[model samples]
Target: MADAAPRLLELAEHALSTPFPLRLRAWDGSEAGPSGAPVLVVRGRRALRRLMWRPGELGLARAWVAGDLDVDGDLYEALDLLSGLFWERGADGSGAGRAETLRDLAAMLRDPATYRLLRSGLALAGPGLPPPPPHEEARRRTGIAHTRRRDKAAVAHHYDVGNDFYELVLGPSMVYSCALWPEPGTTLEQAQYAKLDLVCRKLGLREGRRLLDVGCGWGSMVLHAAEHYGVQATGITLSVEQAAYARKRIADAGLADRIEIRVQDYRDVRDGPYDAISSIGMAEHVGSDRYLEYARTLHALLKPGGRLLNHQIGRRPVRDEQAYRIDEFIDRYVFPDGELAPIGATVSRLEEAGFEVRDVEALREHYARTLRAWVGNLEDRWDDAAAVTTEGRARVWRLYMAASAVSFERNRIGVNQVLAVRAEAGGGSGMPATRSAWLS
Candidate 1:
């Protein structure tokens, strides 16, 4: 039984042409590898079989979601170690997505050890058919990308993962985007409030103004703006669950008179000429091909001189931008059809859409901290969260959030707020002359 771990590690190292970085603990309670390294607990051969058949991000994701694979120590340390091999692959070629992508199968076909490797890997995974994907796994969508119907499905898959589950994870604030941490001692709720207020300030929300929040999650932004800034706020989301949850929250907050929550897609938004617009943590779902359209839509919807604040997650720009592929695990298990663009391209697109890009603030570290807090909340209430959402779904969020936190920490990715405005035809931008007003 103890040989199980060593054999699996040796096979993995040989096949991948690299050292197996994490310690391995096999099903029979066998353990091997560096004594102090983060331990990857393989509960059974099914996890190995999943990895063997899928050979990449999806395989790893399937195993994790199904509970066949798990981490025994600090998740960040384990994922950070694998980040170079299977985590953040960019133009530097750090080997992301799949082990097969890194492995030279053609070379292996010519290698005499290939047959022995295959046989050993097969025997190790044991006798079994490939495991079916977990029920929580999203069904892959078909047809043209970013169609309103497809977008709605995508949103439903991600955001409709039950409001209670989100509440357990996101805390009472329900502000899913990056928080604006003013100080180290700031609580998550406080940071979230600061973030909403910051967006309101940047957009210059005021009494009697009409504000639109695109992809508003659970009504936090609209409620805050309407209550604090006295604006007539409208929040639109494709998720029926989100809309319902947000509407109820707004009613409870006694802001229903000022805020309107609608299950509406951004493209279908007919009401326009808003004084200000906030698209927080939403544009990632707007697919790269539709991003310019998204920008144009926001520009067209806003009044002249009206500001638009877009807070979105961003990836590092690779030398060959066209080569970018959405991570398979994220696409399948998490944000299906979601895409992240470099912030520079995001600014360029907004400017191309007739808006003067006024400011770009990177809240990368803020998001990292926010995710850690959310992960803590989830970990603290793991049973409650898992009860509302399946264990598989909970596992997905855990890995996603923890890995994202590390990604932000290592600068592999970031979240940024791009503030822009539709300049008046006479070129009056209506923005304050100095950054002090906004920064303050």
Candidate 2:
């Protein structure tokens, strides 16, 4: 089985033409590729078994998450390299040759368990084995999709991991959404601060104004508004860990009197007519079927002529549904039931909810930059992050963030800050005629 590893690569040489200079190391003293190349080590028989059983990106993800396979160098680059093999076309404008690909695949399936599974075309979830803990349980959702109970469960599943882990990834700012890079040299903290303040400015937040932040992560925006803008701020989140950490931070910052953090759902918030609302990075979780409900709820929460700055990730319009494969991996491993609607769809829904769309700004490049910065932070603090969360969870984040960055950069996905206003009875939005007031 070990000797066949090298032979398998040799068979799929066409796919490796422009691949990263990486070495493949098998567990049983067998190696492939250049001597000093970055190592992708198959640590045990399980890696091959997984590949043989599932035989595609899913199998690769499972093996990688289970630590059956590991990467020794630039994790982002290695992921990109592997992804290129499946997506990139050959000189003949087609993918890898069928016969060679099949031969290579067969070489990895020589083991008895893998062979049996391959022949049966069935996946076995065993008792003692427990299906490689992380990969097996990653996709388990708690309740029905988009229900109030299910949404809370999904939010908790993703965000309740640990506040310490989030702090490590998000830096001192503690903002989980996209950060606006003011310039090429700006740091992540700076970008996040800018993004938070930008939302404040867009909403025209002022002293004594009541601000509600839906899906606020760690109360970054809430604290910023309370401290800097002098607004009475309220932040809601499903993650109990986030609420606890945010409350502690608010107290420590001497803003407890002005800011509040609650482990509450958006639908449950009965507090009415806030001067402004900020829903950063939360809209994606409101499934398409419930998107209008989400929009309407926020619209109802705002006072007449009140502003809403909703920042969310959105998908680009695409003809090929297969291009959404990355979303499947994301749903399984990272965000359990998250959905990214297209920008147009999002705007239409908001409009349907009676919001006067004041501004629509696509921050695709900015989100890509933000994600890359996060990926870099996670990589730099790899050991520290692993201590906070499992190595498998960290790997899941690292891979998902890198892939999302690429998607944003390529316009496959996007992030937008949609500025809307609850119009008065006289059809007045009470917004500045031009965006110049908010731009500066």
Estimated TM-score for each candidate: 0.96, 0.84
lDDT of 2 by residue, 212-329 (tens): 9999888899999998899999999998899999999999999999998988889999988899999999988888879999999999999999999999898755444333333446
Backbone N/Cα/C clashes per model:
0, 0
Cα lDDT of candidate 2 equals 0.78
lDDT of each: 0.88, 0.78
Alpha-carbon shift of residue 250 in model 1 (angstroms): 1.4
Candidate 1 wrongly placed segments (more than 4 Å): 92-106, 438-440
lDDT of 1: 0.88
Query: lDDT by residue for model 1 over 1-440, one digit each (tens)?
Result: 36788888877777666788899999878888888999999999999889777877788899999999999999999999887676535544343434654345566667677767767778989998889999888896899989999988988999998999999999999989899999989999999999999999988888999999999999999989998999999999999999999989988888878999988888889988899999999999998899899999999999899999999999888866766768888899889899999898999999999999999899999999999999999999999999998988999999999999999999989999999999997988988888887555
- Name the runs in model 2 displaced over 4 angstroms: 10-23, 29-39, 85-136, 320-326
In model 1, the clashing pairs are: none
Worst-scoring 10-residue span by lDDT in model 1: 93-102
N/CA/C clash count, model 1: 0
